[model samples]
Structure formats: structure tokens, C-alpha cells
Target: MKTRQKNSVQGRTPLVLFLALYQLAGGLVGLGLCLKMIPALQQPSTSTWVGIVLAAVLYTFSILCGFLLFQVTRQAFLFSLANQILQVFSFGVTGLAYNYVAGLKVGVGVDFLTSWVFKLKFSLSSFTFSVGTHTGASFVAVNLLALVLLYLLERAKEAANV
Candidate 1:
């Protein structure tokens, strides 16, 4: 019984660790991207400020979600799930705001939702990777994955209870 308990605890360690790290990294990336737009805020309109605020809120949720997930508790899983759902909606709003500011005629239609690209380039001595816009189907997939992870964590907790 002691050995079984130990193994079960160990089994959960990696998943918890991965979730924590993923959240932290995601928060940092989001903050960085938001910072890039700070300069554009100069002489900005109300719409731009609104966009910035929306981005800030979304990224803050991501960071908090990451921290909560690190707790490795059932409560944390629930909170993370809620946060992920909010992030999904906010992501769309933020994208639309930024797109409008940038004068891109893109809309949240099927084409915008489904298009995604990731490219890698290598030279004799250097390697480079490039990705499409920050918001798209790929990001939606990421959010969906996070939601799935939270569900898995919830299941794991339920199993542990059993």
C-alpha cells in the first residue's frame, strides 16, 4: 500500500510541473507582446487603449491560471478551467482590437479562424523560425489544449480520491 501511494504521487508530478511551466511561459510571452504595443499607444485613440486593456486582462488571467495550476489541487483545476474559458473569449476581442488598430480588414470569420502558419528557415550556420499572427486557429488550439489539460488534472484528482 505504501509503495502504491508513492507511485501514484510520483505519477502526478510531471503533469503538474508541465502545467506550471506552460502557464509561466505563456504569461511572459503575453506580457512581452503587450509591451510591443506600448509604443503605439502614443497619441492613441480610445479604441487603442481599449485594446491594450483587453490584452492586459487576458494575459493576466493566463499568468494567474499558470500559478493556480502549480498548486496541483482540484480547486486549482477548476479555477484554471474558468480562466482558460475567459482567455478564449478575450483572445478574440483582443485580436479584433489589434486588427482594427493595424488597419487590417480581417474579420473573425471562418477564414480567419482556420488559417494558421508556422515556418522554419535554416542557413548553413543559422536557423530561424517564424509564425503567423498572434491570434488565429493555432492560438485557439492552444487554449483548447489548456482546457483539456485542466480536465485531465481534474480527472487525476478524482482518481486520487478514489
Candidate 2:
């Protein structure tokens, strides 16, 4: 019985690990882009400051979610699921449902098999991040994918009784 459980757990390891790595990379990429805006903060713009701070907070949560997923515990699954749900609401519903945010413009988007890449820009009127309001599709897809990842994590946890 123990061996069977071990095998079941091992079978899901690759998928969970991949998701963890993806989460970590996404967070890092997001934070790195946010860092680029730090110099712009020297200017006087409340929206810039607000946007940067909000993006940083969201990306930090992504990083934390990644770390929790690495633990592969039942609690981790639950926590990550919560985070994903939040992202879906924040990134998907607000981002796509309304179709736009004031003063925020979607830039050129480069899509990968599992990720999206876009240029980060700072200006007097607008600021953007690599993962910012570049593409509604990317945000929608990523948020949905995150939920799927959490589902898989839950399965892995159940398989291992963890």
C-alpha cells in the first residue's frame, strides 16, 4: 500500500514541479519589470506609484503561492487554489470583463506555450509591465491555467495523503 501511494505521488511530481517553477518564474519576471518603474517613482504621479505598488503586491503573492506549491501538502493546494481564484477575479474579470482600465493601454504581446512576454514601458502618461495590461487573452489564459494547476496540485496531495 505504501509503495502504491509512493508511486502515485511520484507520478504527479513532474507536473507539480513544473507549475511551481512556472509560478516562480512568472513572479520573478513580474517583480523585475516592477523594479524598472522604481526610477519613474521619482516623478510626481500618484497613479504610477499606485500601479507599481499594486503590481508588486500581486507578484509577491504569486511568489508565495509558488513556494507553497513546492511543499505539495493539502494545505498548499488549498492556499494556491485561493491565490489562483484571486488572480482569476483580479486579472480575468476586472481585466477582461470591462475590456480596459483608464489610462492603461495594452501593448504588443508575445505568447509562449505557457507564458506571455511584452515590453515594459514608463512614460509621463502611462506605465506598463511585462505582465501588465498587455493582453486580455494572456491574463484570462494564465488565470485559468493557474486554477488547473491548483486542481492538479490537489490531486497530487490527495494521492499522497498529504
Top lDDT prediction, candidate number: 2
Report every candidate's CA lDDT: 0.47, 0.53
What would the per-residue lDDT of candidate 2 be over residues 50-160, giving only the tens digit for each residue? 767777776677678778777665666676666555543222322232111111122332334266654332221122333334354433322334446658767766765
**Candidate 2's TM-score:** 0.55
How well is each residue in 1-162 modelled by candidate 1, as lDDT tens digits? 777556446545666666656666666676666777688666986656765676666566667766766555556667656654443221232223221111001113222344544322111111111223244332211233434655765665565442
Off by over 4 Å in 1: 1-12, 87-109, 112-147, 159-162
The C-alpha RMSD in Å for every predicted model, in order, reads 10.2, 9.9
lDDT of 2 at 105: 26
Task: Enumerate residue pairs that collide in model 1.
Answer: none
Each candidate structure's TM-score, on Cα atoms with residue i matched to residue i, is: 0.54, 0.55
Error in Å for residue 153 of model 2: 2.9
